[model samples]
Target: MAATVRAAEAGENFPVALRILPARLRSELHATYRYARYVDDLGDELTGDRVAALEAVAAEVRRLYAREPVTDPVVAGMGPLVRRAGVPADCLLRLVEANLRDQDHPRYQSFAELLDYCRLSANPVGEVVLTIFGAATPDRVELSDRICTALQLLEHWQDIGEDYAEGRVYLPKEDLDRFGVTEEDLGAARAGDALRRLVAFETTRAVAWLGAGAPLVSTLHGWARLAVSGYVAGGWAAAGRVRRADHDVLGGQVKPTRSDIAAAWAEGLLRRAG
Candidate 1:
């Protein structure tokens, strides 16, 4: 499980950038990552009653906060770091709630509804991260929310086909109707013009959110600045990939190469410097 978790984390741009941090910080972040990933797996990949599994995980999180014994290895691993970092219980619980919502709510009706889902599913991770860095101020968290939501939308746009296959659709129903896209379009081997236009519209919104959040890098310092710049850069690089693909995300997962991430990272840092 440890090996699998690390392997999966390696593929993400955020974790890839965290490699440069000090060992202690990396370990703390990894513990949080493991717990989040474990919960996500329970929700998405578990064989038995997923809601029950998630409820059990939530219990473990509460136990961790109570300083009681935790049975789950991932939750046990997070206990020390979460306690030490003063991470809020609500942040973790909100994540579990998001997964619970996933079990029942597969399709989002509007972008506002999708954003509400992201408030639960994505934003708390950023809040936890900020808390870990001792930087979870209201202003910073507000900015972090934008970055996190943008990342969530980008991932959704990229995984449209896969999500549709899983009986889930992250794109808003209203947007689909506006673009003349249907569930059938998501299942196609390639995106048609209508699907491409829908992706383009969503991509534009994501980019705007990312841009709105980019100033967060300038507000941070040292490792925090570098780490956040990497995140924002990854978002930009991903947006670039979608644009370059002409917003046809159904061809495959549009992953940004390491070189692409590096270039964007440098450019972002330079922009901040200027």
Candidate 2:
């Protein structure tokens, strides 16, 4: 599991900027990442009874909160940070619940439903990170939700083909129908014109969400500011990649290069500074 987590880190939408962060903060963030990745792997890759596996992780989360011994190494590793940051049990449990939902809910009916799934799968991570930095006010959490949800949408946009192959479709049925994108279109080697149009629409929506959450960067200070800016930068870089591909997501995964991320990072900081 440890090795798998490390390998998966390279492909994350927002790579942990470990070099720029303090040692303790890096460790804390990595612990959180490990826990999340472990749960996701169980839901998406496990060979048998994925729901049961997620339920086990959910039970471990409850144990962590109740001061009982945790059997899962990743959850047990989160003990110190959770206690130190006063991280809410519900935040972590929501992650587990999201995976549980994945087991039963393979397709989303609407964009609102997709956002609700993001509430469970993505927003809680931001909430926990803010709590660790002692910055999770209600207002900040609201902004973080926008940012997290945007990031989740960007990921789904990038992985449309891969997700469809796995018998899961993150694209809402309503949006697909509106754009005349059949499920068969999603599995093709290249996106048809209608699919590209749908992707462009979804990309625009994600970018707007990122813009709505951009204020969260200015509201933070020091490392927190830098970290949040990096996240926003990542979103921008990813959106640019999609646009540069003409929004044809089925051609390949739209991943931003390191240089793209660095350029976006600098631009984000400058914009925030100005």
TM agreement with the true structure for every prediction: 0.97, 0.98
Cα error of candidate 2 at position 181, Å: 0.5
- Across 10-116, the per-residue lDDT of candidate 2 in tens digits comes to 78767665577998888888898888888888999999999888999889889988999898888999999988999999989999999999988999999999999
Candidate 1 at 112: error in angstroms?
0.5
lDDT over C-alpha atoms for residue 223 of model 2: 82
The number of clashing residue pairs in model 2 is: 0
Screening candidate 1 with a backbone cut-off below 3 angstroms (N, C-alpha, C), the clashing residue pairs are none
lDDT of candidate 1 over 237-256, digit per residue (tens): 89988888888898865878
lDDT of 2 at 104: 85
lDDT (Cα atoms) of all candidates against the true structure:
0.87, 0.90
